[model samples]
Each structure stands twice: as structure tokens, then as C-alpha cells.
Target: MTTMTFTRKDPPQWLLDFWKEIDDKTFGKGFDCFAHDAVCNLGVADWHGRDAIRENLRQFIDRGFTAHHDVVEYWDGGSLKVFHGKVRMTFDDPALPVVRPAMAHFFYMDEKDPAKVRRWLGSVGPIEF
Candidate 1:
């Protein structure tokens, strides 16, 4: 893992709830997490706005990927604020020798306030390089 240091800032209730919905396999219903014009750069692809974000996430789930966050760490500073976590992704594919994990990093900005995420630069990767 790369050495990183970020100020501790817990995610808001609404954001947490959105993740809960995702964990429950109900993603499209959580578009409220993203701002109206938020841009998301998912590792495999990039999307803009709530609709595109929903579509991207749906594709991810359909690829047999499910993420579970083990720990959430936050950081904030002058012009930098983010929350990251190390998570494991379970797959339904029998061909995979073992379940893989990934580091989920979110580079978020304050829209009108910290409660809303303005932009998202997210990355998800398989454990094996």
C-alpha cells in the first residue's frame, strides 16, 4: 500500500446511506450521493452526472463485483479533502481462483458544503497487479 496521510473526516449520513443501498444491490436509487453535475472517474471508465454514474455502477455490479469497506479514513486540508478505504470485492465467478480486493479512493470536493460531493475521482483495482 502507498503511504498516505489525510485529515480524519467521517462521511455524512446521506453518503453512508448511499453506500448501504449499494451494498444491498440497490444502486440506481442512491444517485442522491452525487451532485447534479458531478463527474466520476471510475477506474474502468468515467461518467458524468447522476444518470451516468448510475449506469456505470450498474455495469460494475453486473460484472460480478461487490465491494465491502473494512475501514474508512478521511482527510482534509487547504484544497484537498478525501475519504479512502481498503475493501474486498467478492465475485460470483467460479473461474476466479480466489476473491480479490481493491483500494477505493475518492477525491471529493465540497459543493455548497461538505454534505454534498461535487466531483468524484474513484479508482477500483484488483489486488493482483
Candidate 2:
């Protein structure tokens, strides 16, 4: 299997560490990245508050899929950060095909707590080049 290459462009150390937690399957540690009242919008559903978001993420992680994200680029706009990447998801079910989709994360940090994400909007799918 070919290794994924992360081409992150000077993203914050905290953000980098958060992604590490995701790839490492350490959701408990990664939960620190979100504020207590943070909101996550995944297009189809809106997960409000930290506990809800954490539960949503936990469900996804606990499912039979392992995900690896390869960050291709990053844009820092003060409190708003944008990350463009590709995720490779391998499912435990052999009948299911592996999925590699382009993903984008738009994170708005809490003004009072800069280290925490107040709002996160994410999209994943094939994009035209």
C-alpha cells in the first residue's frame, strides 16, 4: 500500500495535532479541539454542542471504517481556517470498495477561546480539477 503524503501549508500546531488524533483514532483527545458549545454542520446534518459533536464523531470512528486524511493545502484567515485534503477510507467489509474523496473543512475558532473551534462546516466528495 502506498503511503499518503500530507502537504499542509503552515497550519497551526494545534490543528496539526488534532488531525494526528483523528488519524491515530484518538477521538477522546481530539475532543479538546472543540468548544463546549461548538457546532458542526456536515451538510446533511447539524451536530450542535460539544457533547453532541463528540458523540457524532465517536459513532463515525467506532464504525467499521478506518480513515486517513492527506492535507493538500491550508488557508489561514485569522479566526477562520480552511483545510483542503483527501481522505482514504478503508472499510472492514471486503465487499465495500475503498473510498478516496476530496474533503474541505471550514473552521471558525471561538473568539473568546482561540484554541477551540466554535463552528465547523465540512464537505466531502469528488471535485472537478
- Over the full model, what C-alpha lDDT does candidate 1 score relative to the true structure? 0.64
TM-score of 2: 0.82
lDDT per residue (tens digit) for residues 39-128 in model 1: 888775668787788777777777775766654676664234565665556667756644445456565755476555677776655635
TM-score of each: 0.73, 0.82
lDDT of each: 0.64, 0.80
> Where does candidate 2 have its weakest 10-residue lDDT segment?
2-11
| Residue-by-residue lDDT tens digits, candidate 2, 4-122 | 34444677777677677767787666678889999999757599997898778768767888888887889877678899888888888889888889888999999999889999999
How many pairs of residues collide in each model?
Answer: 1, 0
lDDT for model 2, on a 0 to 1 scale? 0.80
Candidate 1, pairs of clashing residues? 7-75
